[model samples]
Target: MKRLKYIMWYTGLLAISACSSERIAPDGETEQNIDVHLAAGISESDNSSRSDNNTYIKTAFTTNDEIRLVNTVFFNTPDFTNENTIFTYAGIENNKYKFTQSSQNDTSGNPDGTGSTDDTQPIGITWNDFSPTSFVYMFEAVYYPGNELFSSVPSDQSNVENFKKADLLIAHHRMPLEDRYKDIELTFHHAFAMVKVEATVPTGVGGLPKNAIQEASMINVQTAYHVDYTATIQNNGLRTVKGIEDENYPRTNVKMWLQSITENTAKKTQTYTFLGIIPVPNPNDPNEPIIVQDDFIHFEVKVDDKTTKTYRFVPKENAIHLEQAHITVLKLQLGKNGVLPLLLSAEIAPWTQASAGMILDEEDPTDNTLSGGNSSDDQQGGNQSENQQGGTEP
Candidate 1:
């Protein structure tokens, strides 16, 4: 898979490191940059080939000035180990100094003293507290810097599994002591999935006047979740997720004013498309990650205050859990016909994944703009932070 690249250095970074280090290059070689290829997706899907639409792959370095060498999956020992060799700082010297990935495994994270040449191992590089091991450093991250509270309550919200969407990118691994290894490769899994909704209002329906002004606005929208997404990471990579509410978004039913149905300038045709993040899961058993139902999305029409109709939107599928790094969409179709039963078709794929007859909604704020580059990065960062803030006092 082709590695997604984001060369620009960004600020407001929150890395999951332990302590700071005093190790800086005595020589002037600190300027030479180390190459890090980021694979932020599941292994099943070729991250190399993932399109930007299906995924939002970006980089938040260990620090703005320093690239900390972390102990990840390929480091050393067992099905799930949590001993990190934190290289708070280091500078790569000659090709002889290196960090590498090997097919072999040794408890002692030291380079094979046997002087055997293996392809996966790195050659000619060294760092502080570096250890050579055959273990693979598997990495998965869900970066929800803002508007991401794990648990809140109208009912006992405190015990309700307080999961704070990591304000920073929390990269997990055991730190290896100063050792030499080879080339670096990191794969990232999407901690959360997303879905977008679009409501279609065909003209000449809902007992409206025949002046081509038929439109529907989705108000009081709620993307309720039954499962707590902010799970605690266990030593073995498995998560300890407790049932919790979205503390930041206590009101599941917010207004989807952005996706309201509307007509063209001539006020003739009804727009048939829309988008959104993946809805919350309806977990069948609270203890397990298995989902038995779709997240709830209920809303009323916002265009006309005189019209009072509430619509319930549910995923087409029963189970709704995020596919690591992948997106599961909920496409909605509505009309006065009533016989169609308010259909929602859910499909999982890259961000651009869609089905036949589903029109791309024009209501997206990020439309025509890259999720990473452009001015969207700053705007998105601001929005994330804003979402976490408590509502202003009345």
Candidate 2:
């Protein structure tokens, strides 16, 4: 068994340490500059075990990963807006994850063994004409693949590589800026729900062959998602995941990609696991019950090398409700009784960061006008997995 991997694209803590100083401006006015030092990786808090071996699998951030920070500094001023700050993960140095400002003009001074061999430096965040004791009320952290924050969610996420990029994570926080030397830990949460289906069958006496399963998928699922901070957003939760309104969005079939196949001879059953990521439902009331409608699990099985059969399973009402940052797992038993739901679990855990080896290595992601700079870095950590479900009408 390869162990359950790709639980989520990103789920971990990002520790940003800052040192403060005062620099005199050309007008002889004092300005506060905070030099950011990056020390980020997966902590022991996010851990999970394999069911068979009880071992752990860790995932980490890859080189060139760019994170965007949008802060709304609250002051007594009448006019106020948000400032977008960008940083790129530039490999490890001095046992700390080195991050550099994406700005091409920033050069590292190599102080305290913090600079990488590439001469990259952590960017300084400066506040001009304001008291260093000011406080920032709203801080938004967003990570999009290639470091590009798309105005809208992509219509397609079928490909694992594209899915990895589209696995958007966002975090919102209210922190005091009085402690300029304090480390700001931004914890990102997934903006979408994950659905994983496992199909199983007994191998003998009226049971199908081990190779019977051919393909599996979810039918009539929401394929597109759109989220924005411009709308009313809660302090901790993500903005409601609104489906992208387009001909290709809000409706499509998502093919469940196979992750692993395992056989338990002692149990006399073989299981096929397939997983897919879906957009969370958008309800008018946050507390209202989520109801799934007209959705179905469609599967194909080979009766023999020359014969194939198709089957579908419609979920009973109240069996599943999808929520952002949560995962639902559905298990089906293939037998003479048709496809029947065997095990259904919901919200086992919010989807977390990616497993090992899925990291992207490309650097210099295209600049979003909101922020800029370029660099890269890498790390090692594990993803938490759980025995973690869907319903459709046939």
Candidate 3:
């Protein structure tokens, strides 16, 4: 209904009819300050916690972009004319960081004495200044502020074509405007699912010339990636929303090209690559908890400008969660013969946590043997590479 209404409006069918509406705003001294804090959470099974999850120059570095806060009402009904939303500063500090800004006696300063704690905020919210009824706020880290939840893809933006990528993410959190003037901890779940593709051709694939496997480009992958929420205010003052990515609806018109992450120029072997993170709405039924499930992940791999192999995988069971930038890896082994019966396996993991995320099962040293498996290691995902190095999961 949300999407349809927008389409009608854009097509010049729906126009505002005469209606009287009530508008309210917070008044002087009605505000109270609340501190915001963040905590890093990842799946236990996610080994790519802080390592191979695309760190600076390395894998796994802290996010430095400032976080954005919007009035909950704005997302439910976006109105630039609505002055209800306010942000404290240029940007919130990156995760596990401290506020470097000079402190002021203003209530926006740290209510709790500033400490070098990861995600502990020195700032407070001037709560009373905002709309008393507009209690909930939307927290997210998008490419830019003022991005529409279900808007169209700009021609110049990354997701518009195969050349650029769109990683814009928004984790809609509707927190109650509580009277408690203390620290309020909010968890920003990922509104987008990470789709990582690890495609491999056996050592001696007969179908292609040697140079063909050296370079591969992803032509395009299509899906309905944009979404919106119609939240219901809960008893706890928190709003519960069902995130819908109706594939049957018109395409979000979003496209993605595979990002080659493990192309070894030295060995001339194309191992693995990433399919940039595009929006995939949480398909959870409002009644049940949010668990991303049954979404079709599809892709077409073109090697050396030829041998385009297309594959689709729908997670049979619970898939990767749309949380904290976690990712679900789909490994497609396009057989040595480059024929039908593609061997594919799925693995769910968090970014920056898994060490062997791109490491193929056949090439993984953790394997006890080929054509055979170990029960213990199998349960551990068959790769103890991180364990062997005495590495810790962040």
Candidate 4:
């Protein structure tokens, strides 16, 4: 049974439509307060909550989930710096994030004492002494739970909750000061790469159990990332990513959490799906440098939940360069003498809006799945070297 796993919110994009009413200019001073409506479009893939049978339960934003906004390029307003503004999740309406009057505040978009801490009122942008001008105001919004600085990937990603926090998203939009009253929408993009490992034990492999692997992990990969949220405008009125690859990115081992395991009785084999989220950049312009690194796939074969033999494979394409908004699937086949042959492929799909709180599973065929997975780069019989890492814990 093949179905969409994290189809609903994998993009982690937000759509901020202007929902403000018509505000006439004051008698003396011509000024207008920007009432920007906030909504999240695509969410991070995978669900944190699980059922009793270890099946995943799809869920949307929690009550505490909040999005941080920063008006980097705006007309100079009094007493308002480029401090981080926050917007809380109110509810779901029409398959998008919905907010009410109580959830937002009518202010000058100041986060210092002017913003509400309880979320009864969220910070907003206001243009004082408003007038139609040729200048464009830029905004950069980021969605990361707790609004914490992410210097490195979390060591323990056994749960989707941790993955959600580390999976940072960013949106950049430049609006003309004259169009302040019109509807404005901000689209967010993923800043990390999702790696899906599929491990399979081939049929009739002598001296090996049908289900051989107990746990899997990705070892020694770049974990630290550049966290620049500044928006750069090109001469062609388009936005491009601006930053050099940080050489100081720490390389660390990340444990790949098991998503699902299945036994192919007809094929006489077993397969397991594992997932990991890593911070990687797909530079949109030539100003940014590409990052390459070597990653190792580690698997442990156990018997009765005890210590067992371990296998590690170095891919033929050791200089791995993963991209954002994409899934790098590594298909590995285990042979009898711990020899593993690996096939690597990546899939990039257009993001589609999904119904709020919709859960997609293998059993459900009516749900819409992402239109990808067939890649021309997918190849077999790669020159992969296997290394025995000694007996380890399962």
Residue by residue across 23-104, what tens digits does model 1's lDDT show? Answer: 3434565553333222222233443442323323332222211222343334322211121322121222231112222212
Summed over model 1, clashes come to: 52
Q: Put down candidate 3 lDDT per residue, 114-181, tens digits, no spaces.
A: 44343344333344433433655444322222223333232123322332223333333444655344
Model 4: per-residue Cα lDDT over 149-190, one tens digit each? 566767566676675566666666667766676543455566
Rank by lDDT, descending?
4, 2, 3, 1
Note the residue pairs that clash in candidate 4.
Answer: 9-43
Per-residue alpha-carbon lDDT of candidate 2 for residues 136-218, written as tens digits (9 for 90 to 100): 54555666665665644443444455445555666665556565534444556667766677777666544566767777666
Shift of residue 202 alpha carbon in model 2, Å: 2.1
Question: Candidates' lDDT values, in order?
Answer: 0.32, 0.48, 0.37, 0.49
The list of candidate 1 runs beyond 4 A from truth reads 1-126, 130-183, 204-269, 272-275, 278-295, 303-305, 314-322, 336-340, 351-394
Which of the two candidates, 2 or 3, achieves a greater lDDT against the reference?
Answer: 2
Model 4 poorest 10 in a row by lDDT: 354-363
Pairwise TM-score winner, candidates 1 and 3: 3
Q: Cα lDDT of model 2 overall? A: 0.48
Could you give me the TM-score of model 2 versus the true structure? Answer: 0.60
| Candidate 3 RMSD computed on C-alpha atoms after optimal superposition onto the true structure | 20.8
